[model samples]
Structures are given as C-alpha cells and as structure tokens.
Target: MSYADVNGLSMYYREHGDAPVTEDNPALVLLHGGLSGSDDFAALVPELSAHRRVITADLQGHSHTADVDRPIRVETIGDDVAALIKHLELGKADVMGYSFGGGAALRCAIQHPDAVRKLIVVSFPFRQDGFFEDVRAQQRQMSPESAAFMKQTPAWELYERTAPRPEDFPQLVGKMGEWLQQPFDYSEEIRGLQVPTQLIFADADMYSMQHICDFWALLGGGQRDAGWDGAARPGAHQLAVLPDTTHYAISSSPALAGTAERFLR
Candidate 1:
C-alpha cells in the first residue's frame, strides 16, 4: 500500500519479494489490463517475485488511482510508468504488462528506454489494426451506457470494491472507448528498439496469428533460423504463445510466470 506522486498522478504501487538488483536480476514491474487494477495480478506477482522484487501499480483512472483531467491514452500511461520508476529510484527495471498495460509497457520502453532494462508485452499488439475487426467494433461500442452491463463483470466488482470514486466507473469507460477509437502504429519504433523484449500471447488471443507474427518480426524474431550453436539468431527478443489459454486468461496462466522467468533470467 504505497503511492508515488509522479507525473501529476498519485500512482498506487506495491512491491513484493526481494532480491538485490543487478543487470541480470533487475526489479520487475507488473501492469494489469484495461478496466483492471493491480489486484488482478495479485496471484501472479508472487511467482514472478521469487527471484527479484515485483512492483505492481494501478494506472491512472483505474482501481485505487483516481482519474485525472487528462484522457487515458497509452502514451500518457507510459509516461506515468516511467515517472513512477524514477520516483521509486529504481534506475531501471524489467517491465512486464498484460493487455492494456502491455501497450503502455511497450510505449514506456519506446519513449523512455533508459528507464527499462527488459520488456515483456503480453496479450497486446504494437498496432491498432492488429486487433480483429470485430474486436475493434466491440471496443467502439463501449460507453458509459454499457456500465450497467459491465456491472455484472468481475472488473466492475473490483471497481466497486477499490475505486476511489465508484461513480466514476462510467466516465472511465467512456474515456477508454474514446481512446480505443484512436489509431496508432509503432512498428518502426519497435523495430528500432534497443531494449531486450519478449512478446507473449495466448493461443486464442484477440489478435490474429498473422498480426502477432508481424509484431514479432518487428522485434527481429521469426526471421532466420538459429545455427546448431544458436549463433545466427536475431537479437534477444523472444515470443511465446501459451497453450489452452485466451487473452482473458493468459495473464493468470501459470505458464505465463514460468515463461517470463526464463526470459527475465
């Protein structure tokens, strides 16, 4: 239970487990999905923290963090995350995010490379068009009016239990709808990334398999074969698609932690 006054937001964050920070074992940061809070990662953090400290935070306008006048955009959230990392005096940390948080993590690595040592993006795409058309259509339909329907969901329950102002849920929903409507593509930036990255997805993710492979290619993956000694492989970037999981469940999958630990180590 801690809050950092970073980037004009009283960002809520917490640390779990402990280990000396080093290039090979930097602190790890976890970011939850859209309309979700740090608590969503409560089950996964311990597994990830076994070898190093794990930091989890609620992004602006979600969960314990109150909504500000600013709109909820991935770029803005990315800046907030970078600010928090500095606020904690973490020099640099390994960042891992799921879904909406994953998008922010990627932007953080792209916009504030110095603040991140390694990156993990789970169940997110580098381009707006990477999402299936029907999924995009569904996102477009999100609005304040849909709040009642969402009330039946676990996300809504979490909001009711933890949000600073429960009534603002609809407003948050509206802002997310507006943000999702905006189009963006960061393929060039990703291709030029200097930070080590690992992209993880579910077998039945919201994104098409082709789009996922394209995103990996941007990370210098899936391009060539590794020789017998693995000398011809691309950069340190890696990709993993968890079996028998959907985007909704990938973050909680036990395999997710194991896969990420292997890369983080």
Candidate 2:
C-alpha cells in the first residue's frame, strides 16, 4: 500500500519482488484498465516481479487513490504517471498497460519518451470510430441496479460482462460512458515512437481487435499475421496475438504472463 504525491493528488501503488535500483535491473510499471485499479495485475505482478521490479498503481479516481475534482482524461492520467516516475527518480522504465490504461501508457510514452524504456499495450484502442460509439450507446441504457453494481465491482468482476452477475452494471456503465466521452487519439503519436514497443491483443477482446490491427498496419510494416507471429517492425515495434483469451486475460489467465515475459525478455 505505497503512496506517492503527484500534482497535488495522492496515488496509491504497490511493488512486488526484488530488483536492484540500478539500471541493470529495470522496472516495469503496470497500469490497469478503466474502472479497475492496480488489483487487476495481482496475479501477473508476482510472476513478473521475479526478474524485474514491478510497480502497480491505482490511478487517480480509482481504488484507494483519491478521486480527482473533475473527470479524468487519458493525457492527464499520463501526466500523473510521468510525475510519479520523476518523484521516484526513475530515469526510464518499461511500461505495460491494459485496456484503457493501455491508452494512458501510450500517451505517457509518446509525451515523455525519455522516461519510457519500452512499451507494451494490451487490448488498447487506437481509434475513435463506430465501435466505441456502440459501446457508449449500450452503456447509456443501463438500469439503476446495474449501475450500482458497477461502481463497487471487484477488480476481477470488472473484466467480463457475463460473469454471472448483474450487481456492478451501473458502475461499469458509468465508467464506459466516461471512457466514451474522453477517448484518446494516439494514432499519430504511436507511429512516431522511438522506443521499442509490443502490442498485444486477445483474440476475443470485445473492443479493440480491429482497432489494434489497424494500428499495427499504421506502424509501417509488412502484412499482418493471423495470430502470434511476433511480426517485426521498422523501429523495434512488435505485434503479437494471444489465442483463446478475452479482454481480461491478463488477470484471468496465467498464460498471458508467460507471453508477456517472453516478449519483454
């Protein structure tokens, strides 16, 4: 339950395993998806921590962190992360973001390339097209019961809609609405990334499969592969697909950790 002060906001974070502070053993900053806090990486963190220092944080307005006065935006969240890295005096570190956090990580890396050694975006959205519009429309119709369930949904329950429960619908719906209103466009920024990056997508990710594919294409590479081909890129960019996994595989499946470790290594 560590905490850091960034731009007048209190950020809650957790660290696992042991690694030297020197650059020899770089650290990995893990950012969870929207509406979910650091808890989303509870399982994967331990596995990753064995080799590298792992840091996970509850972004402002989520989990133990204090809520922001205004609605959170992706760029603003990115800045918060930047500030945290500076406060810790970490010159540069690897970053892994899931879902909405994936967008935030991209923003952070693009805005502060010097602070990021490598980037890994999981099930990240790169465009703001009709797919997001559909998600927004569906969220607007959530009933009160569903809305209430969403607000207090546990981290694991937030991964899938068919988790055999209807309690967190309202909260999930509200978060989805918020996401729609404040979507990010990092397409141009991502194309210019100088640091090494790895884009991962789960086969069944409800939201960003096509968008992610489109983004990979925009990276100026050869034809895309169907699944985990580990396609090469012009400037250290790589794309991999995780089979038989959903949007929440990072938390729900241990296989994702192995894949990530192999890529990062």
Best candidate per TM-score, number? 1
Off by over 4 Å in 1: none
Q: What residue pairs are clashing in model 1?
A: none
Screening candidate 2 with a backbone cut-off below 3 angstroms (N, C-alpha, C), the clashing residue pairs are 146-169, 146-170, 147-170, 147-171, 149-167, 149-168, 150-168, 150-171, 150-172, 151-171
lDDT of 2 by residue, 167-236 (tens): 4334444555666665456678777788788888877766655676788766764464434665443457
- What TM-score, computed on C-alpha atoms, does each candidate reach? 0.98, 0.83
Candidate-wise lDDT, in order = 0.92, 0.72
Candidate 2 off by > 4 Å = 130-134, 140-146, 149-152, 155-176, 223-232
Q: Write the per-residue lDDT of candidate 1 for residues 1-265, one digit (tens) a residue.
A: 8999988899999989878777667889999999999986777888888889889999999999999999899999999999998888888999999999999999999999999999999999988999999999899999999887898899899999999899999999999999999989998999899999999999999999999999999987888888899887777988999999999988889899999999988
Count of residue pairs whose backbone atoms collide, per candidate:
0, 10
